[model samples]
Target: MAIVLRYVDSLDFVKERFIGIVHVKDTSSLTLRNAINEVLTSNKLSFSQIRGQGYDGASNMRGEFNGLKALILQENDTAFYVHCFAHQLQLVVVAVVKKYDGVSDFFEQISLVVNVVCASCKRKDLLREQARERVQKGLCSGDLETGRGLNQVTTLVRAGETRWGSHFNTLISLMKLFVDVLVVLDFVKEEGGSLANRQQASGILAYFKSYEFVFYLHTMYDILHLTGTLSKQLQRKDLDILEAASMVRGTMEALQSFRNIGFAIILPKICNLQNIGIDLVKQAPQLLEYMAALSPCDSFAQFDKSKLLKLGKLYKYDFDDSDMIDLEGQLGIFYHSCIKDERFTSLKGISDLSRLMVSTGKHRDRKCRKMFSKLKLLKTDLRNKIGDEFLNDALLCNVETEALTKVEDEKVMERFEKMYAQRGQI
Candidate 1:
């Protein structure tokens, strides 16, 4: 059990410090709480000093009645609990991949292939040699580019059960060394050290060379790569909650867009590879609809009115019930009223900082004044440099002039006749 603490330094920067890990006999709430208390006591800290706690969404840790969080809160009610974002992302990827039996089978076979190929030093050397030959041949034919970081030799990377990004790297490495892997698998099947080994290798090689496996390999590579990028961004220490919420929403939209049109984009490439027909495209697995609806809602509660409206539109598909729609309508009205209030808009820049300081309630010192003065100077400089013309241009750059207004939506269908006519040309 790794323990860490997050705190704000004198400079007003948030920092995480590593606390000593504790080994407990069991994961019960009492045991976990005792372990934590031991760590705190050894470090000369008190339970009352804890402002927040973050852990994975485990029953023993996050349970409402008898979890570590509850036990800690009993002592110090101010220690709020937050679920770890990185762990949540890993769970999301795991759930999405396991939604399809074929995807689960693909990962299982890939793991077996990695274990078989890298079981011995001789096989490892053979793989490296084969990969080197392939790179040389491709370079000579002008099919591969030569650069500092391009076309470097790659080794098999085994995917971990916990690390979501590892699967993306493993799939990418497999695709890069596809021919070498096939050659090694063929060798193992034809002449193995034992009969049982040869049989296993033969079965795996057959599955590895199949067109279905290839389809999933490419499909998951695209999907996992995007999620992996978002996961990395969320894991950054300096990431703000607002930015993380925006990234989560953007990723969901990208996934939804891919679900709607990715088959068309990937089909041509797959067909060119193995002369497959359109039937394969029709048989391709669709992304789960619920996956596109997943977003970090807790962080989004801090969003401004404009951002909230954009979020509502993005998640409008999930609000299938009247109750949800009504709730969202009320939320929109609340944010709209807040936006109309001049004081709220004026104080928006420092609201986040103010909230943070209020939570700690430690800004009654000189350090707080220094931080405030720096922010004031920054605001003054930004106001002086950014003119009305610049603001107007920034807002107008991406505005769609052809968009229909509220009046058109309320009127008859004929109001869009001209717009539909213009759209037909493209």
Candidate 2:
């Protein structure tokens, strides 16, 4: 387990600092809790100091009764939990969509076809030759414009399962070179040197020509296009929670709109969408709501004083009753102070607002969201599937297993001995 702390400094500027890492025996909640306490004790930080927890939507981390979130909350009730935003995005678009057999099979066949076409020098050359001929035909028919560097032909890029961009590019390349890909597959099927190669080509050709594949290809292309912008924005280092929420809401609206019109247009072939994004929430609703209430968009048009006060109440250890009482009045004064002040006129996010508050001597105040991209990068497009520790891997340097075991053995084993009540088992 790794921890990246999002905390305010003396200057009240929000900072993300990489913190301690613990490689536990396993990811069970009890083990995680022990590891967490071990890190906190080493740093002289306390359980009471934790005001929030965010993890990806793994059952081990976010499970209602036994997750790490629940385990921590049991020790300290103030440590509320929220699911990771980017993981929620992948849930809605990539992971959920692939649950459908047609969509699943579509991607499977695409991988097979790309592999076959790029298997050797001769077959790859055939693809480029076909693509060149396609551009030539398009140019002659007035379907494509001549340009200095516009029509350069290239081989198809195979989609990587972990990259939405790669999947999108594969869809675009397939659409552009649909006829060309078909030609290559046909030649291999009829005149290939090996029977196994011919059989594979024949099966792929049959699958590609099926109505199911074509529908899935075009449908996923549109859905991915709709989601592409939000996905990029979510990964941006500068993105704050408020802007992310807005973009997420916008993406959901786009998806809903697409469903309304897209299904209407293709109502006749709408049988296989049973498992695509059945219950996707952009993120935990409570998290979005709490964060959304703190937005400074449109000169604090969305700011809710009551909700902002609730934030302080959420972290009561950091804010007492006097602070809360003072906060209620401060909220009103800050709103006008910011509105009348020209320095805060163009502010559209919480991070910018936090910084402005500090610069203007409102410093006695504070507080997050861009590290999920780092988490995603750790998942790496090469993995067969993203494991539960994707969040843990991002924030801390990997500890050498031998050193980690030796370094933390006493504390961990002592804790386990106390918990298990069998001292001699060690």
What's the TM-score of each model vs. the native? 0.62, 0.74
Clashes of each: 0, 0
TM-score of 2: 0.74
In the range 1-426, model 1's lDDT, one tens digit per residue, is 546677776546565554434567888889989888887898899888886787777889998989899999888765767566667778766775676677788899999989988988888888999999988999999999998999777789999999879999999888888889888888888888999879878998789768878787877787887788888887876766545655776777676666656756776553332211111111111111221222223332344444433434433333335635554556555445545544344432223444444454533421110222332443365576655444333333223122223335435455555556655522
Report the C-alpha lDDT of model 2 over 1-426, residue by residue, as the tens digit.
566777777666666666644668998988988888887889899788887788877788898999989989988988888666765676666666555667777788888989888888998898889888888898999999998988888777888765666778888888877888889899999988899989999999888778887778877787777666667787776777777777777777777776656755754655657335323335436656776776767877887888777777877777789888878888788877877888887887777777777777785643324344455556577763755455454344342232345556689778888886783788
- Model 2 lDDT at residue 389: 58
The global Cα lDDT (0 to 1) of model 2 is 0.74
Native-vs-model 1 lDDT?
Answer: 0.65
Top of the candidates by TM-score: 2
